[model samples]
Target: MTYTRVCPLAEIPQDGALAVEIDDTPVALVRSGEGVFALSDICSHAEVSLSEGEVYDGTIECWLHGSCFDLASGKPTNPPATQPVATYKVKVEDGDVYVSLGSDE
Candidate 1:
Protein backbone atom coordinates (compact mmCIF):
# COMPACT_ATOMS: atom_id res chain seq x y z
CA MET A 1 0.00 0.00 0.00
CA THR A 2 1.03 3.57 -0.52
CA TYR A 3 2.13 5.38 2.61
CA THR A 4 2.41 9.06 3.35
CA ARG A 5 5.00 10.42 5.67
CA VAL A 6 3.40 12.09 8.65
CA CYS A 7 6.11 13.23 11.06
CA PRO A 8 9.33 12.36 12.74
CA LEU A 9 9.11 9.49 15.11
CA ALA A 10 10.57 11.64 17.87
CA GLU A 11 7.70 14.07 17.58
CA ILE A 12 5.32 11.59 19.17
CA PRO A 13 5.78 11.25 22.92
CA GLN A 14 6.01 7.78 24.34
CA ASP A 15 2.56 6.54 25.28
CA GLY A 16 1.10 9.72 23.86
CA ALA A 17 -0.87 10.77 20.79
CA LEU A 18 -0.32 13.36 18.10
CA ALA A 19 -2.91 14.94 15.85
CA VAL A 20 -2.15 14.92 12.15
CA GLU A 21 -3.89 15.39 8.85
CA ILE A 22 -3.59 13.55 5.57
CA ASP A 23 -5.44 14.85 2.55
CA ASP A 24 -7.65 16.86 4.88
CA THR A 25 -8.52 13.78 6.86
CA PRO A 26 -7.73 14.07 10.56
CA VAL A 27 -5.77 11.21 12.06
CA ALA A 28 -4.29 10.38 15.39
CA LEU A 29 -0.77 9.01 15.50
CA VAL A 30 -0.28 7.14 18.74
CA ARG A 31 2.91 5.81 20.23
CA SER A 32 2.52 2.97 22.68
CA GLY A 33 5.60 1.08 23.79
CA GLU A 34 7.66 0.33 20.68
CA GLY A 35 4.81 0.37 18.23
CA VAL A 36 3.09 3.30 16.56
CA PHE A 37 -0.56 3.25 15.58
CA ALA A 38 -2.89 5.40 13.50
CA LEU A 39 -6.62 5.97 13.88
CA SER A 40 -9.37 8.36 12.91
CA ASP A 41 -8.89 11.50 14.95
CA ILE A 42 -12.61 11.79 15.49
CA CYS A 43 -14.38 9.88 18.22
CA SER A 44 -17.08 7.51 17.08
CA HIS A 45 -19.64 8.59 19.67
CA ALA A 46 -18.94 12.29 19.57
CA GLU A 47 -17.88 15.01 17.21
CA VAL A 48 -14.71 15.44 19.26
CA SER A 49 -11.13 14.81 18.33
CA LEU A 50 -9.75 11.66 19.81
CA SER A 51 -6.22 13.03 19.64
CA GLU A 52 -7.17 15.40 22.45
CA GLY A 53 -7.84 12.41 24.65
CA GLU A 54 -5.75 10.24 26.95
CA VAL A 55 -3.53 7.36 25.87
CA TYR A 56 -3.01 4.32 28.05
CA ASP A 57 -2.49 0.58 27.79
CA GLY A 58 -2.71 0.62 23.99
CA THR A 59 -5.96 2.57 24.06
CA ILE A 60 -6.96 6.19 23.48
CA GLU A 61 -9.82 7.58 25.57
CA CYS A 62 -12.22 10.19 24.35
CA TRP A 63 -12.05 13.26 26.52
CA LEU A 64 -15.62 14.31 25.82
CA HIS A 65 -17.43 11.16 26.94
CA GLY A 66 -14.82 8.83 28.39
CA SER A 67 -14.86 6.55 25.39
CA CYS A 68 -11.74 4.44 25.01
CA PHE A 69 -10.71 2.89 21.69
CA ASP A 70 -8.14 0.23 21.07
CA LEU A 71 -5.17 1.59 19.21
CA ALA A 72 -4.82 -1.42 16.95
CA SER A 73 -8.44 -2.28 16.37
CA GLY A 74 -10.15 1.09 16.74
CA LYS A 75 -12.87 -0.69 18.70
CA PRO A 76 -14.39 1.09 21.65
CA THR A 77 -13.66 -0.62 24.92
CA ASN A 78 -16.20 1.18 27.09
CA PRO A 79 -19.66 2.71 27.18
CA PRO A 80 -20.94 5.91 25.58
CA ALA A 81 -19.17 4.70 22.45
CA THR A 82 -20.30 1.40 21.09
CA GLN A 83 -19.26 2.26 17.55
CA PRO A 84 -15.75 1.58 16.36
CA VAL A 85 -13.55 4.13 14.68
CA ALA A 86 -11.36 3.58 11.64
CA THR A 87 -7.80 2.38 11.99
CA TYR A 88 -4.94 2.74 9.55
CA LYS A 89 -1.67 0.99 8.97
CA VAL A 90 1.46 2.65 10.30
CA LYS A 91 5.15 2.23 9.70
CA VAL A 92 8.31 3.73 11.08
CA GLU A 93 11.28 4.13 8.86
CA ASP A 94 14.49 6.10 9.34
CA GLY A 95 13.15 7.68 12.48
CA ASP A 96 10.06 8.91 10.63
CA VAL A 97 6.46 7.83 10.90
CA TYR A 98 4.44 6.98 7.80
CA VAL A 99 0.76 6.16 7.60
CA SER A 100 -1.46 4.56 5.01
CA LEU A 101 -4.85 6.23 5.19
CA GLY A 102 -6.10 4.00 2.41
CA SER A 103 -5.25 0.92 4.37
CA ASP A 104 -7.99 0.63 6.92
CA GLU A 105 -7.62 -3.12 7.07
Candidate 2:
Protein backbone atom coordinates (compact mmCIF):
# COMPACT_ATOMS: atom_id res chain seq x y z
CA MET A 1 0.00 0.00 0.00
CA THR A 2 1.12 3.48 -0.82
CA TYR A 3 0.59 6.20 1.74
CA THR A 4 0.45 9.83 0.81
CA ARG A 5 0.81 12.77 3.12
CA VAL A 6 -2.47 14.64 3.15
CA CYS A 7 -2.06 17.31 5.79
CA PRO A 8 -0.60 18.21 9.15
CA LEU A 9 -2.02 16.81 12.34
CA ALA A 10 -2.91 20.31 13.53
CA GLU A 11 -5.06 20.92 10.48
CA ILE A 12 -7.85 18.83 11.94
CA PRO A 13 -9.24 19.74 15.31
CA GLN A 14 -9.72 17.23 18.07
CA ASP A 15 -12.84 15.20 17.38
CA GLY A 16 -13.27 17.10 14.15
CA ALA A 17 -12.88 16.40 10.43
CA LEU A 18 -11.28 17.85 7.32
CA ALA A 19 -11.86 17.38 3.58
CA VAL A 20 -8.84 16.68 1.43
CA GLU A 21 -8.24 15.55 -2.13
CA ILE A 22 -5.62 12.94 -2.71
CA ASP A 23 -4.85 11.62 -6.18
CA ASP A 24 -8.12 13.10 -7.46
CA THR A 25 -10.05 11.36 -4.73
CA PRO A 26 -11.99 13.31 -2.15
CA VAL A 27 -11.24 12.00 1.33
CA ALA A 28 -12.46 12.97 4.77
CA LEU A 29 -9.86 13.00 7.48
CA VAL A 30 -11.40 12.61 10.90
CA ARG A 31 -9.78 12.92 14.29
CA SER A 32 -11.46 11.18 17.16
CA GLY A 33 -9.84 10.72 20.52
CA GLU A 34 -6.14 10.23 19.76
CA GLY A 35 -6.63 8.44 16.44
CA VAL A 36 -7.10 9.66 12.91
CA PHE A 37 -9.35 8.00 10.33
CA ALA A 38 -9.78 8.43 6.61
CA LEU A 39 -12.97 7.89 4.64
CA SER A 40 -14.62 9.00 1.50
CA ASP A 41 -15.68 12.60 1.79
CA ILE A 42 -18.94 12.02 -0.05
CA CYS A 43 -21.84 10.82 2.01
CA SER A 44 -23.21 7.56 0.69
CA HIS A 45 -26.81 8.67 1.08
CA ALA A 46 -26.73 12.29 -0.01
CA GLU A 47 -23.48 12.81 -1.84
CA VAL A 48 -22.75 15.71 0.49
CA SER A 49 -19.43 16.43 2.07
CA LEU A 50 -18.96 14.44 5.26
CA SER A 51 -16.24 16.75 6.52
CA GLU A 52 -18.87 19.48 7.02
CA GLY A 53 -20.67 17.30 9.54
CA GLU A 54 -20.19 16.94 13.26
CA VAL A 55 -17.98 14.25 14.76
CA TYR A 56 -18.80 12.45 17.97
CA ASP A 57 -17.86 9.10 19.41
CA GLY A 58 -15.92 8.03 16.37
CA THR A 59 -18.80 8.83 14.04
CA ILE A 60 -19.41 11.68 11.64
CA GLU A 61 -22.92 12.95 11.03
CA CYS A 62 -23.89 14.16 7.62
CA TRP A 63 -24.92 17.78 7.94
CA LEU A 64 -27.48 17.50 5.17
CA HIS A 65 -29.60 14.58 6.34
CA GLY A 66 -28.31 13.83 9.81
CA SER A 67 -26.95 10.45 8.75
CA CYS A 68 -24.09 9.34 10.94
CA PHE A 69 -21.21 7.25 9.62
CA ASP A 70 -18.62 5.31 11.55
CA LEU A 71 -15.12 6.66 11.03
CA ALA A 72 -13.50 3.29 11.50
CA SER A 73 -15.72 1.27 9.17
CA GLY A 74 -17.34 3.94 7.05
CA LYS A 75 -20.65 2.28 7.66
CA PRO A 76 -23.74 4.33 8.38
CA THR A 77 -24.68 3.93 11.99
CA ASN A 78 -27.94 5.84 11.60
CA PRO A 79 -30.82 5.91 9.18
CA PRO A 80 -31.15 7.72 5.87
CA ALA A 81 -27.83 6.19 4.95
CA THR A 82 -27.75 2.48 4.43
CA GLN A 83 -24.68 2.27 2.25
CA PRO A 84 -21.22 2.41 3.62
CA VAL A 85 -18.63 4.84 2.43
CA ALA A 86 -15.14 3.78 1.43
CA THR A 87 -12.57 3.79 4.21
CA TYR A 88 -8.86 4.18 3.78
CA LYS A 89 -5.90 3.38 5.96
CA VAL A 90 -4.49 6.25 7.97
CA LYS A 91 -1.22 6.89 9.70
CA VAL A 92 0.31 9.74 11.65
CA GLU A 93 4.02 10.33 11.54
CA ASP A 94 6.02 13.30 12.75
CA GLY A 95 2.88 15.29 13.31
CA ASP A 96 1.74 14.70 9.76
CA VAL A 97 -1.22 12.66 8.58
CA TYR A 98 -0.91 10.14 5.77
CA VAL A 99 -3.56 8.10 4.02
CA SER A 100 -3.45 4.91 1.99
CA LEU A 101 -6.21 4.07 -0.50
CA GLY A 102 -5.07 0.56 -1.21
CA SER A 103 -7.99 -1.52 -0.05
CA ASP A 104 -10.66 -1.70 2.57
CA GLU A 105 -9.40 -5.17 3.46
Candidate 3:
Protein backbone atom coordinates (compact mmCIF):
# COMPACT_ATOMS: atom_id res chain seq x y z
CA MET A 1 0.00 0.00 0.00
CA THR A 2 1.08 3.51 -0.81
CA TYR A 3 1.14 5.70 2.25
CA THR A 4 0.53 9.41 1.81
CA ARG A 5 1.45 12.06 4.30
CA VAL A 6 -1.73 13.85 5.23
CA CYS A 7 -0.75 16.26 7.95
CA PRO A 8 0.95 16.64 11.29
CA LEU A 9 -0.55 14.59 14.07
CA ALA A 10 -1.10 17.76 16.07
CA GLU A 11 -3.50 19.07 13.46
CA ILE A 12 -6.14 16.62 14.60
CA PRO A 13 -7.66 17.76 17.84
CA GLN A 14 -7.61 15.42 20.77
CA ASP A 15 -10.77 13.32 20.91
CA GLY A 16 -11.87 14.88 17.65
CA ALA A 17 -11.84 14.22 13.93
CA LEU A 18 -10.38 15.94 10.87
CA ALA A 19 -11.69 15.78 7.33
CA VAL A 20 -9.20 15.24 4.52
CA GLU A 21 -9.11 13.96 0.98
CA ILE A 22 -6.64 11.48 -0.46
CA ASP A 23 -6.73 10.59 -4.15
CA ASP A 24 -10.32 11.88 -4.29
CA THR A 25 -11.37 9.82 -1.32
CA PRO A 26 -12.87 11.68 1.61
CA VAL A 27 -11.34 10.41 4.83
CA ALA A 28 -11.69 11.20 8.47
CA LEU A 29 -8.57 11.44 10.59
CA VAL A 30 -9.67 10.72 14.12
CA ARG A 31 -7.68 11.27 17.27
CA SER A 32 -9.02 9.45 20.28
CA GLY A 33 -7.24 9.15 23.56
CA GLU A 34 -3.60 8.58 22.60
CA GLY A 35 -4.18 6.92 19.23
CA VAL A 36 -4.93 7.99 15.68
CA PHE A 37 -7.39 6.34 13.28
CA ALA A 38 -8.47 6.71 9.66
CA LEU A 39 -11.89 6.00 8.17
CA SER A 40 -14.31 7.14 5.53
CA ASP A 41 -15.52 10.64 6.16
CA ILE A 42 -19.06 9.87 5.05
CA CYS A 43 -21.63 8.30 7.29
CA SER A 44 -23.23 5.13 5.98
CA HIS A 45 -26.74 5.94 7.16
CA ALA A 46 -27.13 9.62 6.44
CA GLU A 47 -24.43 10.21 3.87
CA VAL A 48 -23.13 13.05 5.97
CA SER A 49 -19.62 13.98 6.92
CA LEU A 50 -18.45 11.86 9.81
CA SER A 51 -15.63 14.25 10.55
CA GLU A 52 -18.16 16.81 11.75
CA GLY A 53 -19.56 14.36 14.25
CA GLU A 54 -18.62 13.61 17.82
CA VAL A 55 -15.72 11.36 18.77
CA TYR A 56 -15.54 9.48 22.03
CA ASP A 57 -14.45 6.14 23.37
CA GLY A 58 -12.94 5.09 20.07
CA THR A 59 -16.16 5.78 18.19
CA ILE A 60 -17.35 8.57 15.92
CA GLU A 61 -21.03 9.48 15.92
CA CYS A 62 -22.83 10.61 12.84
CA TRP A 63 -24.09 14.12 13.30
CA LEU A 64 -27.25 13.57 11.32
CA HIS A 65 -28.57 10.22 12.51
CA GLY A 66 -26.61 9.59 15.68
CA SER A 67 -24.89 6.51 14.36
CA CYS A 68 -21.68 5.79 16.18
CA PHE A 69 -18.92 4.01 14.32
CA ASP A 70 -15.84 2.32 15.65
CA LEU A 71 -12.80 4.24 14.59
CA ALA A 72 -10.61 1.24 13.91
CA SER A 73 -13.13 -1.06 12.24
CA GLY A 74 -15.62 1.48 10.86
CA LYS A 75 -18.43 -0.68 12.15
CA PRO A 76 -21.57 1.10 13.23
CA THR A 77 -22.03 0.61 16.92
CA ASN A 78 -25.66 1.73 16.90
CA PRO A 79 -28.67 1.64 14.66
CA PRO A 80 -29.54 3.68 11.57
CA ALA A 81 -26.33 2.43 10.04
CA THR A 82 -26.13 -1.27 9.43
CA GLN A 83 -23.32 -1.17 6.90
CA PRO A 84 -19.75 -0.53 7.92
CA VAL A 85 -17.73 2.25 6.39
CA ALA A 86 -14.23 1.89 5.05
CA THR A 87 -11.17 2.07 7.25
CA TYR A 88 -7.62 2.71 6.18
CA LYS A 89 -4.20 2.07 7.63
CA VAL A 90 -2.59 4.92 9.46
CA LYS A 91 0.90 5.53 10.78
CA VAL A 92 2.63 8.26 12.67
CA GLU A 93 6.23 9.28 12.17
CA ASP A 94 8.00 12.29 13.60
CA GLY A 95 4.71 13.80 14.73
CA ASP A 96 3.30 13.57 11.22
CA VAL A 97 0.37 11.43 10.10
CA TYR A 98 0.34 9.10 7.13
CA VAL A 99 -2.59 7.20 5.62
CA SER A 100 -2.91 4.36 3.14
CA LEU A 101 -6.06 4.07 1.05
CA GLY A 102 -4.96 1.12 -1.04
CA SER A 103 -7.17 -1.18 1.03
CA ASP A 104 -9.32 -1.10 4.13
CA GLU A 105 -7.50 -2.28 7.22
TM-score of each: 0.96, 0.96, 0.96
User: Per-residue lDDT for 83 in model 1?
Assistant: 93
lDDT string for model 2 (58-102, tens) is 899999999999999999998999999999999999999999989
In angstroms, how far off is 2's CA in candidate 3?
Answer: 1.0
- CA RMSD per model (angstroms): 1.3, 1.1, 1.4
Which pairs in model 3 have colliding backbones?
Answer: none
Poorest stretch of ten by lDDT in candidate 1: 96-105
Tell me the deviation in Å of residue 53 in model 2: 0.2
Off by over 4 Å in 3: none
Candidate 1 positional error at 43, Å: 0.2
- lDDT of every model, 2 decimals: 0.93, 0.94, 0.95
User: Given candidate 2, what's the lDDT at residue 52?
Assistant: 96
Stronger candidate by lDDT (1 vs 2): 2
Native-structure RMSD, model 1: 1.3
Residues 17-103, model 3: lDDT tens digits:
999999999999999998999999999998999999999989999999899999989999999899999999999999999999986
Where does candidate 2 clash, by residue pair?
none
